[model samples]
Target chain A: MENESFYDFGGPEPEPARPSIGRLSTVVANPTATGVEAVIEECAALSRSLDGILALIVATSDGMLIHSTWSEVEGMRAAAISAAALGLGQRIASDFGQGEFHDSVVSTGDRVIGIYAVGDRHVLGVVAAAEDVTLGLLHLSARRTAQAIGRVLSDS
Target chain B: MSEIDVINFKLVVTGPFAAGKTTFIGAVSEIPVVTTETGTSEGREVKDHTTVSMDFGKVSVADESQLIELYLFGTPGQSRFDFMWDILSKGMLGYVLLVDATRPETWTDAAAIKAKFDELGDVPLVVGVNRGTESDVDKVVAALRLDEAVPVLACEATDKESVKQVLITLLINVVEQLEATVKGSI
Candidate 1:
């Protein structure tokens, strides 16, 4: 007795909208409370553990300095250069089909600058003396520190 | 579309390679200029290096007790690096194209770059003829076939005041254009 003509022609119903997940706001309404203290504390610890370290900076992917052990001008320059270096490195990696860029290193006569990828949106820049530190040791330390900083940045 | 509360403005300095765009931004920027200079492979004879990405500088303007921060971006002039031009110019209030007035051969390139910007959107721009004598201004203007309404003036990129004047002129043009846009909408 069911009327077949009344059957609906529409396809499978659209899946229920995924439940919205909460995240830290990208646009902070208040400038004073940015929750950056955790990252700063982590950077401070990282710097204290290393010998002959000139500077340690945590910066956003977009070149904003988050934390640094150096002066304001030095920190700002480190942040900017870190961002630029990573950008160029990423481009080179992608163009060459080299999966997963690790880090970039620039060694001068007296010092060495290392930029390591911290999470999806942060970078860790470390400047240290070239005389005392071996490249392997420097890279390993930077990698560990970057991973630790990444967790701090990712937590809500 | 109403964003009067925003006090930060971005202006792009674009032109052909070796046009003194980087020097101009450095001359007026309060902060240390950030540059991405790589060794030149093609034009080593003219200059040993060229900007691969962009140069950034920051300046502050005080108008009637209101503080406005101005960010200057210098574009890479090489055609191969034009991809960066799009990225730097986004949301920019205006731009200045610096032409090396002594090198008349590069005038057409400057005009072409301006035309490219024009295709992007209606943004105010001025042509600054740099490193040219006062007499070179007229010849440069004629060679570029500049429109009468556009401001073309001689500028020394190394001198901070000259660069500041050019920047101010560009800002004036931006304000006027913004007003026109608002009036038309109303």
Candidate 2:
């Protein structure tokens, strides 16, 4: 009675569900699986929904790329930039007693780059032409997209 | 009115994961260190937090004749954050590569990071073997394939004196390189 176990009532527990060989092969062949593809699709949808959006990138807080609309080299660069920007923003907020940082926007002569936190471990960067997108509109759209990206990341 | 000559130098601290770059900077910095640390996902068993982007700190050495300001920049140790390595290396006078003595498995990663920094520029580099003895220093030199000219010193990253010694060794190398460059110009 002191050493009673669930196995006593049901013999040995049924073998834990094993991944199918085909599924295992897919995972082996393409390490970036359906989850990554879903994240990429979310990025694409965000880019398509916004007018004059030049790029949308999802990157880990550590600067690893999850997905991006730009070319591989450009996306990697943007991912690093995004991570740095998010870090700096969070630092500034904490230092000044501003509470948790939500997002930051850098407006250049030709474009605006918005960096938004997606949950705690990820960030979403949106680049849009300054002339075509208003700051208010950009913020609204980007915040929504960031929330969506966060959901996809958590689900994955 | 007498004016003191002022000089500014940037020294980057980099290493493999959990090698103590942040601790080294925090121990020596005069100001509160500015860190970009995040909760670790993969290496949680070893460390609860890791630098995601960079850590910045400043220290000043002043004498009657001159004032030297050192801006210390620490980089994220993971390869995923290698992009920050290139960004932080800009305008750096020299760099210190730290290695953990207890974790031999990270030596390969440290060596790879060393090679990457070598490709980034011709800046002077010093290897600080943290929490290590003199024997460990020799092992680090061999494992990292360091040149005879490079300084490899045993250090405790959490100790101010030990961290200062590593910085002084690196500064010496930087000064030597500068002197050589000036001589070549002459």
Which candidate number would show the highest TM-score if scored against the true structure?
Answer: 1
List candidate 1 segments past 4 Å from native.
A1-32, A60-62, A98-100, A118-122, A131-156, B1-10, B31-56, B63-66, B82-94, B111-126, B131-154, B171-186
iRMS, candidate 2, in Å: value is 22.2
Give the per-residue lDDT of model 2 (tens digit) for A52-152.
78767777664545666654444544554676687667766776766987899888897788999987667898778888899898888888878877777
Indicate the residue-level lDDT of B182 in model 2. 76
The all-Cα superposition gives candidate 2 an RMSD in Å to the true structure of 20.3
> B50-85, model 2: which lDDT tens digit per residue?
998887776776779866666687999999888778
Clashing pairs for predicted structure model 1, backbone only: none
Q: Tens-digit lDDT track for model 1 on B91-136?
A: 5678898999877888888888988888755788898989977788
Off by over 4 Å in 2: A1-156
Which candidate number would show the highest DockQ if scored against the true structure? 1
What's the distance in Å from true for residue A4, model 2?
Answer: 54
